[model samples]
Target: MEVYSEKQQIRAAIDALKSKNLTLGLVPTMGALHDGHLQLVKKALANNDKVVVSVFVNPTQFDNNEDLVKYPRTLEKDIALLKTVSRNDILVYTPTIEDIYEGNTVSENFDFDGLEFEMEGKFRHGHFDGVGTIVKRFFEIVKPHQAYFGEKDFQQLAIIKKLVEKHDIPITIVGCKIHREANGLAMSSRNTRLKPEYKKAAPFIFKTLKTAKELFGTKSANKIIEWVEKQFANHDLLELEYIIIADTETLKPVKRKSNQKSYRAFIAVYADDIRLIDNIALN
Candidate 1:
């Protein structure tokens, strides 16, 4: 597998493959490699002639400086993990901060319709703008036929879809299923920071979501939200941040279930300083 740090060289390498009429798939990631990320790579490899997996931890995406500093970086381990995925030369792009941000590192402002004003956006100001900026940059740099993203970041996935639609970017955005641990906790790079006991309690987040899903049609959305709030309220280790039952398309919180629209239960929890988010479809 050929690993590259420079954008120009990476683009040249991709262009070489494209010259032979090879189809390309791109999987953009912040490094701390795990099975969840590899699943994305596996999906990309299955679909395209070649794949480019980027492992740059984007600074613009983090609203909290501490979270940014504390965020794990395992480039060597990441490369080793990528190697285990396939014998095929997966083009691994690990750009430096200077490569991605150049001199001005400020995030570009984007209007994600009203989608930016809810959930993660409300909590992390300018977060989606960073996401939109970096993602758009990757689209420009990689120029792949199709790009893969996991559905774990459901809101981000929606924003990206909106981005592609609004800009008319010529690429298919494939949302893969959320990868989870045996305990049902959603996989995240931040999972690395969880303390031992917090890690043990982490699976409760998914369990609560599952229970909430079961209560969906029987109870009102607001009632279910109350119940979930209570569940996390009583938990010693995990603290609930926000929970919303929203229409899948618009992401506006719904008071009651509608047969006409699909809905999902989205939740954010904090195990001390480490934040974890998870969602489940409640159709």
Candidate 2:
């Protein structure tokens, strides 16, 4: 496994691989390697000749300074975790903020076809712009044949696909399944900040999502939404942020379920200070 912090050297290495006709896969991540992240690496390795996993906590992506500061940065442990599943050709790029952004850390404004108008976009404000800028930068830097992203951030996955389409980037954006703990809590870097009791109650979020899925066809979207809200309202530790049943493609909230249209139940919750989000497909 080769680790690099310099962009030029990494690009040179990638050029060498390309010369040999190697198919490269990229997994862009903000480091705090859990089994969920390793799963993405494994998926990349299974499909490509070589894989590059980036471990930089992008400042542009964080809307809140406190959230950015509190975000986990376990690069040493991240590298060790990667080593467990990493092959010889796996390149871990640990670039500094200066390396990624040069002198400026500001995000580029992007039009995600109004896909950024709801949910996180409404809440965080300019959050997707930052995500778009950093992701676009990663695509330019890596120039990989395929890039992998976990579907836990369902809306963000949609935005990224749109990003590639709008730019006409010749790269496959692969969406992997949302990985979860044995207890059903969706795996997130923020999970590290979860307190002991909150962690114990966190699995309730997934349970609520499951129930909402079960109620999809029989109950109205609004009914399911109401039920999910009520479930969290009674919980002692978890506080519901937003829960919506929306079409999978357009991401518009659906009042009535259509047989022809696919839908998903998306939920955001706060286990005290830690904000976690999860979604389940409802067909």
Candidate 3:
């Protein structure tokens, strides 16, 4: 329940916890709490003795300024939900733009170049670099034994793992499952932005991806993408961003192979102005 805006105070508190030899876990978030974020908390709490959930909205991560401006922030309700989840010993850090970036500061560059410009990377240029920088800073400040991320953002999970290894951040990256809603749409705070009609129609993205999963063994990559594209094409509310079949680990497009190396189906769609991302690992 204790909130620490100052880095020194937060570190001091972490130091006190470390003195007792309790395990430290960090769950970095952007405030707006949902079942997906809670799933991460549950995983972290189960693994470590002391769980610190960070609630800072890093401006650098958003490729679109309007999207950044519209990103939700509901700290009071979020904290109340955290308490209900039995996560009271949280070290919430909410930093000002100046606190994160000082006086027109030049940020350090991370070499995610090739990895940066593909799929969502191609869609959101320099987005992962922004994610890398903020996450690196969090790792340094919290010095947690482990950091948790949700697998819904499978690509982000992959990037952060590499970032930790490349930078020698000394923290283990743990990924929890992709949480979902009753209708099968991936639970996201942005789901709140969708209109009632669009919300019901939104689950079609998951259905399309799931249908692609069902057709994986029988169909080729191009066939699968086309089928998924057609499904979304008919839905007026849903605007297809990128639909691709790729190797789950590499995120490279999957070629038509009879061997079946377990491809992944990922789709990013915009229902009206609200963007929602979801994916399914082909069986």
lDDT of each: 0.93, 0.92, 0.83
lDDT of 1 by residue, 15-87 (tens): 9999999999999999998999999999999999999999988889999999999999999999999999975
For residues 72-123, what per-residue lDDT tens digits would candidate 2 score against the true structure?
A: 9998899889889964869999999899899998999999898898777878
66-184: candidate 3 lDDT, tens digit per residue = 99899998989888888877756566776666666765533467875355666888798778878898889888889999999987888888889989878777899998888999989
Error of 3 at 36 (Å): 1.0
**In model 2, where do residues sit more than 4 Å from their true spots?**
none
Model 1 weakest 10-residue run by lDDT:
85-94
Native-to-model Cα distance after best TM-score fit, residue 250 in candidate 3, in Å: 1.8
TM-score, cand. 2 vs. native: 0.99
Looking at model 1, the pairs that clash are none
For model 1, give the RMSD to the true fold. 0.8
RMSD of each: 0.8, 0.8, 1.6
Model 3 stretches astray by more than 4 angstroms? 105-107, 258-260
Listed per model in order, the count of residue pairs whose N, CA or C atoms clash below 3 Å is 0, 0, 0
